[model samples]
Target: MNISRRALCGAAVLAATDLLSFHVLATPSAPKIRVGILKFGTVNWELDTIKHHKFDLANGIDVEIVYFAGEDASNVAMLAGDLDIIVSDWLWVSRQRSQGADLTLAPYSTAVGAIMVKDDASIRAIPDLAGKKIGVTGGSLDKSWLLIQGLARRDHKMDLTRESEIVFGAPPLLSEKAVSGELDAVLNFWHFCARLEANGFRRLVGADDAAKALGASGPVSALGYVFHDKWANENPNVTMGFLQASGAAKKLLAQSDAEWQRLAPIVRAEGRELEVLRDRYRQGIPDRPIAEEEKDAAKLYAILAELGGEKLVGGAPQMAPGTFWALKT
Candidate 1:
């Protein structure tokens, strides 16, 4: 992560491709790495940064990004050899590995939600959320909400869904409803929560706190870079080079507001909106994969397992020791 700025900036920054540029060449002896990404997910920001800064070319990895409409489609494409790496959760990676689909995970991006409420709302703690209408996206099984549930049960002996009046809706609708006083509070996504924060919504609790209470070592990263282990073993240089480039991009974005401004138009954000995005994003940037040696990692796994049951996380009793890919190891 402490790599030279030149490695991140790359020599080809002068010839950096346009944001919409997708042209990539594959030599007879060197096949380009096919990276799959959701069109609007956080992964897009990182991939776009790599492309706009020419980091891929500088690292000698001929990269071609394949866009998918959603995670399900992206999973299909990865299995069909249409993608070498994809943005996904460690849970999915573990599930795939259990099904004999050799895969590995590396920390890439992390974002956590917040319980946003009116500035003067009386929702001071998790217990206050009880009996109040709360808007939630991703339904009852969203990872953040699940972590909150786990934390509540473990620390406060309260069942959120049973105690609170829960409403499920799209994120934009949830935000609007919360703003208009139609909903008492909104357990919204990080970006949306950031917007709400900028608009003066008070946070009752943060998903990061839930993650901590559930025993994560640091910021809980629900998302990561997943890649085929076979391909990586066969092309170690490309793998490490790609990760190095990614780390540099993370560093640059975390440290420079100018970098956020550069990509603002792409994200359709500016001013306070852009600042929130930048702040929330930098706050969740993960430094490494979870290690079993760490107590928090094991505790988090237990919490997720208890909350999600075997079905949600592919029935893994514990996070596989091989789930993480260490850049140095």
Candidate 2:
């Protein structure tokens, strides 16, 4: 109890330093969220914006964006644990979950795509696409194609794959083929479809209408941010933080047309291409999802179930419950 003043001062300084160390350990840098994206994919624009704006950092997540040549490459990398998340459709998530992948889907963009036909082509409606040479992006498992087939079966009672000459090609190649009259019509992704429309190609049925054509009640999730359920459960903060960052990005894009100009260069869109891209991005921003028991959710589920039945989703019967993670809620 008779310590010298110098010794007392040293002890106080040591205690303060230890407390500072504890604070540093308690609050380390944000957790890194490794995300996979395809080169030239539309998701790239939002993600790149997130990086430039530091939205992920603001939301307490360190986001690392990884690029893949295609979805196949991304899928392989994700399964190998190199990726924490990827942008994909709900049906794809369901199919993967059905196969026991334990994946969860968060609404990314509802921008389902569209079919583009010539301004003067005989094609006028969905059924008009029958017996015509149609170009499709992705492979036989493309969601747009599968949805179209489902529409054909439900409305015209025809199997489009059997009726139409379906040709699978890359999005750019498909666009070229359609413009050069090599294909009568081309089913393209949202951004590509927008460009084709801007270039004077007629917009036929878009995926939203395609969903209506197949009897969906309300808005359906066309594409989403997908992650492993186990990983998400283990790192709840990272998952929630990611969704918050994404929501902020979506809000910015949804509200500001001027913001589209900022992303145009990154997406390589210009002139009419830029306008189309802006419109599609705005249109694809989805409302917060409702409960699974809601009528709209049920109807959306049914549409996907039929599309899945057509093998668009690797032959899953229906979307397994818990496939959709309403993290925003």
lDDT string for model 2 (137-229, tens) is: 877767667777777788788887888999998889999988889999988887888888888797887767876666666666677788988
lDDT of each: 0.73, 0.72
Q: State each model's C-alpha RMSD to the native.
A: 5.7, 12.0
- How displaced is residue 86 in candidate 2, in Å? 1.4
Question: Quick one: best TM-score, which candidate?
Answer: 1
Give the candidate number with the greatest lDDT: 1
lDDT of 1 by residue, 1-329 (tens): 33322332232211233333433332445457788987887677778887777666656676688888887999998887778899787777777777778877766656778889999888888888889999998777677788888878878899998999999999899999999999999999888898888787978888778987666667646676788877776776788667755765676687778889889877768888889888988877764324422335446666777788876766677766556654332
Question: C-alpha displacement of 316 in model 2, angstroms?
Answer: 3.9
Q: Can you list the residue pairs that collide in candidate 1? A: none
